[model samples]
Target chain A: MPFSLLNLKALMPEIFLVIVASVMVLLDRAVREKAFFFWMALVGTVVAWLLARESLDLHFGASYLSDHYGFFFKTIFLLVLFLTILISPGYAKREGFHFGEYYGLLFFAVCGMMLMASGTDLLVIYLGLELMSLSIYVLVAMAAGDPRSIEGSLKYFLLGSLASAFLVMGLAVLYGKTGKIVLSELAGWLTSDKAVLTGILFFIVAFGFKVAMVPFHMWAPDAYEGAPTPVTAFMSVAAKAAGFAALGRIFLLAFYPAYAYWVKLLIPFAVLTMFVGNILAVVQTNIKRMLAYSSVAHAGYILLGIVSGTKEGLSASMLYLLIYAFMNIGAFATVVLMQREGRVGESIFDYQGLAKLYPVPAFLMLLFMFSLTGIPPTAGFIGKFYLFRSVVHAGYPIIAILAVLASVIAAYPYLRIVMLMYMREPEREIKLAPSPYIWLALGLSALGVITIGIYPGSLLTSVLASVF
Target chain B: MEKVLFGYLALAILLSALFAIFSRNVVRSVLWLLVLFLHQSVLFLTLQAEFLAAIQIIVYAGAVLVLFLFVVYLINLREEIRLPKFLGSYPLAFIAVLSMLILAVAGLVGFVPAKTVGSLSPGAILKVGHTQILGEHLFREHILAFEIAGVLLLVAVLGAVVLVRRLREGEL
Candidate 1:
């Protein structure tokens, strides 16, 4: 309970974001220029990013820790927020739903993501998770004219509340079994007790639902497709990364003693997730839903790192998550760009012969598609390589092979888009939504993907160093 | 006296919960839910948790139930009542519920409550008072979480305004 200066400093960025977001909420009502909120959020994110620093000290009774691990995820969250805001104004304005609450909610969501990454206690992490989920539910329902948006939001809210209930139950059981909630302290109370296993299983289910692992991923496609493109992009990467952040920390720290048990339990789920996501993605006509499935598959890949139960594996997942934020958001940014007056650009066939006219977006989409397929010379390849190598190193060569097969199946849907863009003629005349900011966001993502794709050693080493 | 009150509260809770779920009239169902909430609060009171009892009444019975009533009022109650009371797949739902009940009972039957030593034990709660002890923890140890909850409420309000407001072009 002692609030030290250092602890206050550790929480500076989160506090700053909360303040800025609250002020923006006020400003949004008074200001006429919707673009003003965008600038505020953008500047706020930059400031928050600069304020973030790695502090190994655990603040507030081991509830929060500002460490390099959290710092890495925070950077990703900020990057996502920046990119999402960049791509949002045009879509929001075009769709006639431009509001300051949109940007404010995003800031709050990022603050939640930051807390999730940094929190070392179950209570804190749960609070963070709820904060993030609530913001996202509202964001998804922002398009008032679209019934699909409301449906998706409601679905997400219901399923998410169930998951939260499960998590609370798990936390209660764990607390009863151990009288502890802090990650480091919980390790000391490890037992082969049935209650502990039950609690752990509940936790796994909740995390699985959060990260969109198969069987628990029923809401992802519906929610992703129905949501605004920018929100979809934000949720797919930032929210999933937050889930994995907490998952990795809890498993590696609190449940490390029972790694063999949980790893075995998780492997099948991961394998199922990869196959379900990839195979289902192939049949999707909507680009957003396809990317939703693709994101689910990517979650399966990230789980390989945790399933390996190695520092290398954990860092590998972190690296993959960073790469994913870029390529996935980049893809969604393109979808946001494809939104014309009448066409929302939800269908994959809409991209046909796009290379003939809007060659730049077509090529950018091509780059993203290739990257998603884990093609070399892109960040996705580097990410997949590390994840596979780490899993193989952990002696799960079979899971690694299955992951590769899943990746192969994944190649078909992603490459099909590439082929469609270049080969088929446009079924109709395509006019893109005008957004200068989207280009900036897309360019940043492409740069991140290609730069890290080619020169991955530096990013990899930093990620390796950051792992807790 | 405590045992008698506890027995009555528990029975009332179960009966009201059943009534809430089975009532054909949606408003009547919500009213039954209010009864369930009231019984739950009395149960908490019997347990000597005055703060929880108060919160159960204020938050659940007072606030949440009222909100539920408002929502039910907004919708066409006659049409809702006319709609099928249950989905066609009730047998499947029954099976799922039965299995879950069995599993939960099985889990609980085998479980022995571990003696969790903490600063605020039952004896301490009686000495320090329930609300004060809770406030201390809320404002002291878990202050960050408390603050986060505040922000969450703010976002929830924002969400309500954003979703329900009329789309005004430029001048609102």
Candidate 2:
């Protein structure tokens, strides 16, 4: 193959991420300032977003499509990355972990996610998954002073390696069956034989682990609680988005024929994930652990869309991911800002009387909580509505009903946070410094949540057009 | 001769894979992985997939395994730590392994009878099905994916650099 600059242009987003991550790592050593790293990562993410947007004009054939679906998810990933970087400075300063390496690792991870979003080949997708997972393991262990972080890192590493092995084995089986590894070829092969069905099941299992569906979710709470707040936020939103993106492509293309076989399997797991996640969250005192369970519930909702087995279902999943990115990141940003003297207060009691002590953050946290609970006038509500509607449309009314029940159960914990913040008296006086970057992120996310809730038609139309 | 050679290679691969998974020592496991990788490359060669065989050697056996070995050495697994008594249920592990072996053997027994042994001249195999042919197909049919793989590799390289970058005190 003759390498051309034109070919490089096709990889603008990826190139941008790589360059930014490289520069960030180099500048971390040269600058000796933490704030600079944060701003650099933020700017890098924005630049990558712009490059990703530009690449939409150059969509190729089935083997490498860069359509609206990829761009939409990439945009969501970039937004999540920006918010994570925005809230990171405070957490990094407090935890004494403000290194350029941190931001660089994040950039590379995001780059991997974007690649996964656009990938049309199984090999490319696998490579992207590995890239993302490898960086995340390092990020989880980056907090050197915390034993919990090390433990979390080790656990995540072990489970993630197992998941990778499963995924690679699935790929091997699929390739052996079809003598092809490209998505287009696999789609064609799906129509021919039933043996590929087993391979597809293995792929779905791998994705289930990545998304923390019920039986595969044991590692999530510990990992979420142990990692720094910003990293947790990044993992919950960006990592989940990448996993869903890859899973969506595989289901919609390679495993379309086997949907009948697996949708039944997924429905039960989705129900269990939602039920267990919400019930567990209700008992959690640690804010991070609660959010972890909430994330598991959100994964369940996303899986509900996958079970719908229609273009509409896939579109709803994508829309839900956008809203999830905002809500999860905003929630974590508040957590990061709430830290005092290099330590985050994770217990629900730490938030007692916060409404009076820190009104802005308190209010923002309330908005995020409401959004997560899927209340009206929030993105979460709209996301859930679309997801349920799609599932019902696919003749899964019982599943839709169960989902609503789960959401109602889930809302109790989200509202509990709000009640603790606004309705309770202060145990002690607290001093809070408001960071402008975090405020910006919170405001944007809140606005996004509200706007999408009010008028979701446009986003829905775009999502439907992309998926179909 | 070709069939015998291929059978020997397949046996080597299966044996090495079993050793890699079941070995007590990490170093021995890595060695078994190296052996399996080498056997895989030979299988690629038998199929006249010279480019893939070369890639198997250079990328998997050479670069990736070397990196794995380096990390293993850096960690310096002390016997006390590495040989810690099995904390999980050994009986369960044994049962799982047994079930896996049974399933694998059953699947192979079912598949081997249906396999077609295609015969071609050595000249035809080398000339039409070598590195050049693979390159042509990769460049022509799968060009976009090929480019994407390049970008992915570059990102990984950059990511590794970022992960290992040093941080000074008070410098986030």
Candidate 3:
């Protein structure tokens, strides 16, 4: 085939992201200050975002798409990536992990998420998943000599590769039934034939693993607790978003005709994920592990949107994801900034009297925690409201009520952090001197949560417009 | 003649796969895997899938087996090899395997794959040469996937480098 501009136009954003990642790696050296990569990555991601915006309607044949759906997802990824890079430099410097590889691998992960969101074919999706997973595995282990880092990456990698195996096996089964690898083709195959139960089961298990749902969530707390803070923040938002993107496309788009079977399959898993994630989060002393379980619970809430299997449901998941990127990243930014002077302030006690020490960051952390707990006047509230409202509207009111119950239980831990930050006294004088970039990351995330919370109408309109 | 050869190949593959799973020694298990891969290639050849047969031999038997061997050599497996832990409780394992086989076959019994053949027929592919025809599809219709594959490889390369590269000058 000729190299048509039309065909390649849709891939411009992904191509640009990868190019930027490569350029960053090459430019990782020559600059003495490793933080320079952060600035460069930020600039490059913004440019890629602009490029993505331009191709919002260009669906490139069967293998890729650049529609508003993908464009919205790519925008979410870039948002997460931007904030991650903004906070990474300071965190890396503090943790003795100031390496060039960290910034480059982060961009590599961003590139992979972009591809996964844009991909219309299973092969492309699978490749993108691995690319992201590979980069993340390395990024998790970046603190080379740290025993926790090594242990975490090992557990994450082994389980991650097994999930990859399951995913490929699932794809093989689907292909065997239809002899096609494109997502669009499967729609026709399933609509005409019996739904392949084994194939769909594998997909659920694989995606379940990636999104850290229960029974497949054994790796998450350890990996999150042990990974460098910024890395954890990046994966919690972006990696999970990519997994949900794949799940939305594969199930909602391709296997949509067999929704009955899959929705029945998902409802129980959703309830279990919600209960396990929320209940487990409350008992955690380590803030990182608590957030990891919180992420799992958040994932369960998002799965509520998926379970409804309506267009509104899919967009609700996307909106929740958008709000989640800002709120969760903002929460982690505070933790990342607190890792100053070689003291990893990961324990819940570390936050005692944070308001007295650093009023601005403490306030920002409180705002994010509120958003996470789905309190009113926060984006998290709007996100969860829309998710459960849509699920209820879709005739799953019981699940929605159960979800609300889970959220109430989830509120206790988040509020506990607030109590520590505001009411309790510090054991020792905790030092927190966040860099300018950390401030910027925290400020932007805080602003995002507030702006979206006050007026979700505009963003919700756009999100609804993007759904197929 | 082809039928008889296919039967022989299938039997060899089955036997080698079982032995590979049950083998006491890792090295011997790898050898069994090689036999299985070789038989698979032969079976592919019998099915008129020449390109797949070649890939089965080249990529699986040649490249992947070598990588497996390298891994075996890289780690200390002597203790593991001497452990004699070849999945104990033979009766239960045998029953489990038999049941899985039965269920799998049962599930697949009436399932017929819809014909979604690529641009070239097997006969035409034979005439055009395996590599060339395969290259055409890979580069033409699936070119986007091809580029993505290139990106995957690049990520893998960077990952390997990041894992091994020492950031600071060390006393070691």
The number of the candidate with the highest TM-score is 1
Per-residue lDDT for B89 in model 3?
86
Cα lDDT of model 2 by residue, A272-327, tens digit: 99999999999999899999999999999998888998999999999999999888
Candidate 1 TM-score, true structure as reference: 0.94
Tell me how large the interface RMSD of candidate 1 is: 2.9
Candidate 2 global Cα RMSD: 3.9
CA error at residue B60 for candidate 1, angstroms: 1.9
Error of 1 at B16 (Å): 2.9
Models, CA RMSD each? 2.6, 3.9, 3.5
Per-residue C-alpha lDDT of model 1 across residues A1-468, encoded as one tens digit per residue: 344443577788999988998898778768988778888889999999988863344464557888899999999999999999899988888667777777888989999999999998888999999999999998898776677788889888888998998899889988887778788989988786777877887898899889999878988988997788889999999999999999999999999998878887799999999999999999999998899999899999999999999999999999999999999999999999987654457788888899998999999999998899999999889999999999999998989999999999999999999999999988876878857899999999999999999999988999999998
Q: Residue B99, candidate 2: how far off, in angstroms?
A: 6.7
Highest DockQ, which number?
1
Residue by residue across A40-136, what tens digits does model 3's lDDT show?
7888889989999887778666788887888888989989999988888766775666756677788788888887888899988998898899989
Off by over 4 Å in 1: A1-6, A54-58, B1-12, B79-105, B166-172
Worst 10 residues of 2 chain A by lDDT: A1-10
